[model samples]
Target: DERLGLVQMAIDEHTWLASEAREGETVELLVKSHPHLSIVHFTLNGADDVLRYRKWCWSGPMFRMITMGRCGDTEAVVARACRDGADLDAGHFIMGPQMPDISSSAARSALAREDIAAAALLLHPEVLLWCREHKVWQASTEPLRRDERLKHTNRPSGTPQQPC
Candidate 1:
């Protein structure tokens, strides 16, 4: 399996990427060998200076480079916006589980608690217990379960979070 392109990827010189479109089952791509490969994903809508096409819209609000050429008047602006966006990067990807959206009652109950984020790992009791045996989240100060017994005996260190 590959990244669904739900998150757009980056491509540079001599690089390529393929993904399924969000709208329907279709593949959209472009290939070119330019004297100067300044290729990047950009809005090709209303782009007349595009080397080959006047406009390209296989998927509305889509991304992926068409080709490399001089659209410095417009492409330059898009490139600058990309740069500004990068400069505003936060610690989002640094310290968090990168799990996909979980849509269960567990998500709601856990989120209702203010300190749930304090748990390094959020899992059901059985899973959390397994993690403990594997040396995961064994040293957190956040309670793993509402049942204090779940915290006391099975804890690998016999020292679970303080206030269960």
Candidate 2:
């Protein structure tokens, strides 16, 4: 019951924070709850990490929002967070496939008929990959960047290439 209470409280507070734009205060609250805040930017960046954390209740919506470009600071936060071992747990987070929020019964029922392609169209590459890996969507490989070019020359293992 106590655990349930905390979950409820956290959900309530999270909703309030997002709706109210009380970003600073919400971030402070997160920092206070987790010790990693000391060495980490626990506000926005950690929020992405949180999205990538399966243990967190906000993962699904948050990940979806971030991937959909619906969140305010998701890009900046995620970029900054990567400098500090974000990838270390990134795979773990995606592998588990967190459950979507279903507290709103209507939404839960609606999801029964939801289309995976539509959902995938709204997600980031990482989230798209996660969804595909989990069988929520059929995987389609993203095209390589046109500017992403490489150059090489034929050479033997024991010799460097001569001038062309």
Candidate 3:
């Protein structure tokens, strides 16, 4: 919970920086603050306009963020990608079967990793479809949905807002 709070603060700081400056320093600060989060690296360098940003996200660590289920960050990236008219299906394909050097089993394992349940909530339709086709969807995501619901209902009203 503390880590999530720190991440929310970083997201807030990132938002402020994006409005105040155009340099990479904001992203750098985020990375320095939350180096363990793949989302931080993706957010820093993937702030360009939609097409360029999507291209960068696909090419850089942002793709991992997507798979890792950093929901707020992934949502922001996806929103930008959609705005730029980038095809979500292509991105899904790349992150799924087309990812370099990983076998299907490995990719499936990656998808079913600890954070994957959250990842499923934000995944593109194509990726979700792929998971369903591969029989990995319901088993992995259902329990997470239940847990998320409980967490949401139990959280206090004063909790800091995430940057989704």
Question: Candidates' TM-scores?
Answer: 0.16, 0.18, 0.20
Clash pairs, candidate 3, are none
For model 2 the local lDDT of residue 6 reads 22
Q: Write the per-residue lDDT of candidate 3 for residues 1-164, one digit (tens) a residue.
A: 32232233335535553221332346677777988985333322222222333453344324322332232344555566567565556543122121223233443454556445544554444454444444442344232343443343322223332222
Candidate 2 clash pair list: none
Residue 110, candidate 2: alpha-carbon lDDT: 26
Q: For model 2, how does the per-residue alpha-carbon lDDT over 14-94 read when each residue is reduced to its tens digit?
A: 555322223244446767788675522222222334445422333332332222121433444455445544452543222
lDDT per residue, candidate 1, 51-121, as tens digits? 13322222122333322233333454334434445221231111112233332334334433533453224
TM-score, cand. 3 vs. native: 0.20
lDDT measured at residue 15 in model 2 versus the true structure, 0 to 100: 54
Highest lDDT against the true fold, candidate:
3
Where is model 1 more than 4 Å wrong at Cα? 1-98, 103-153, 157-164
Off by over 4 Å in 2: 1-70, 88-90, 93-164
lDDT of 1: 0.32
